[model samples]
Target: MTNQQTLPLPMALNMTLGESLAKRRTGRAFRANALTDDELSTLLWACAGLTGDEGRRTVPSTLNLKAVSVWVLRDDGTWRYDPAKNQLTRSTTTDCRRASTTHQFDFVTKAPVTLAFVLDHDVANTIRESCFYVDAGTMGQSAYLAATALGLSGCIRASFDHKALGEAMALPDNLEPILMFTVGLPEGK
Candidate 1:
């Protein structure tokens, strides 16, 4: 609903299935280089955006629940990913990426883009609680694969203060932060 900038990404990129799979890994170190807005857009689309008029999405949800929403943390601030429109709506002006993880993870805060996967438990009420993890896992893998194919390094991290992160981001009561995926270009050797 707010004014958001949508970047124009190439409709297609040259990547084979095997290449993308091989590229998949948890990248803890990242370059400070900023990810182009277009790459960010494409990454979001590949994760959960609507892919057709019938309203099917890039990733499958339980009963088409589509309960998982992504919040992107960048230098500017935290923004909600609007998959329907393929844009990011600014939510806060403060960068909370540093506060996301506990000290044990050797957390890297320099990644240009950090994606927080927030699940709307209310929407998936019909499904059992145990099943939510399955849905979240599927979405996470999709995001990882997409990032690899896009020539970006990505990692799905579960290390974070869930309650604090949810409150800091001012997320809706129904939305629970599940997984955090940090993405960016790799630093030169």
Candidate 2:
């Protein structure tokens, strides 16, 4: 049976958009500290969580397909964030951070949380591949602002072995990995 972790209500990130924009900067150096459930919830929500009852999102979906999904990877397991439920459904017992990064970026392995942006073809069959990437890119930008507002460090990467990661997460064929956003406490903090 798959275990589900209910995310706590997201903490309001206090920084303004301008402040967050000014503070936002990509950093790959992450301290080996796991994000608290609250932090992860807030970040995930910022990335693509639902905002209204009409099934809208923090980031826009091409033609409102809402096909994008965020997969959370940490030392404990791999999880898929269900925005409708605000919960994470565990997908595997093994950590798949290594598969989420390229050989050149060992720092990714040291980060405590990596969010895999994915596109579900089943939900977006009519959309082109470029649309999938644009949607994911917007979510990545949101994640960067959220991390900065939360006083965390993060970097978005597309250097991972997609095939390896898909297999590691045991993702269904319909789900395609688009990007990886890794976040954690800044190193030396």
Candidate 3:
């Protein structure tokens, strides 16, 4: 494990659920500028961060499997979000943002950060495979709303080369990539 980068406390996301839903849309373009730690923290917390003392997450887990793990890909490197500690642990020194997208959607590489959601099948036990996908979608919607509330833009996609991404991130055999949410400031912002 590498040194953990503690995230700044997220700003209060006061937007009503309806408002966020109304504002949310697929990000068509992105600026190259990086998101601040505050923005990244809020966006990530909304995706899968721990809530309350009992250890529930922001997004509901099917069968409470809590099988999805979010890995952040950036220019600097890849990092795994550790919700319990509210920090990011470095996963690899390789920059895998471009590899996280297919050639048709290569534009996504322009975004400063891409969040890859991987499902830990071992943690999921014998549940149906579809259940893990549901968990990923749940977190994706949360990320969309949170991005809208934070004035950031994002696009959730499952179009990447799964095998290549897994190798680039150095994921263990048990982890399966479910989706990737590319995020950043909108162009001309």
lDDT of each: 0.77, 0.90, 0.88
TM-score between model 1 and native: 0.90
Q: Residues 20-119, candidate 1, lDDT per residue (tens digit)?
A: 8887887777788888877887777777777788779878777777777888887788889887777778878778687667763343578877888888
lDDT tens string, model 3, 67-166? Answer: 9989899988889999998899987889999888777445577899999999998999788889889899999999999999988889999888888888
> Which of candidates 1 and 3 is the stronger one according to TM-score?
3
Per-residue CA lDDT of model 2 for 1-189, tens digit only, reads 558999998999999999999889999888998999999999999989999989899999899887888999999889999998999999898798888876845788899999999889898887688998999999999999999999999999998888888989999899878899999999988
Ranking by lDDT: 2, 3, 1
How many steric clashes between backbone atoms does each model show?
0, 0, 0
Question: Each prediction's Cα RMSD?
Answer: 2.2, 1.3, 1.5
Against the true structure, candidate 2 reaches a TM-score of 0.96
lDDT of 2 at 49: 92
Off by over 4 Å in 3: none
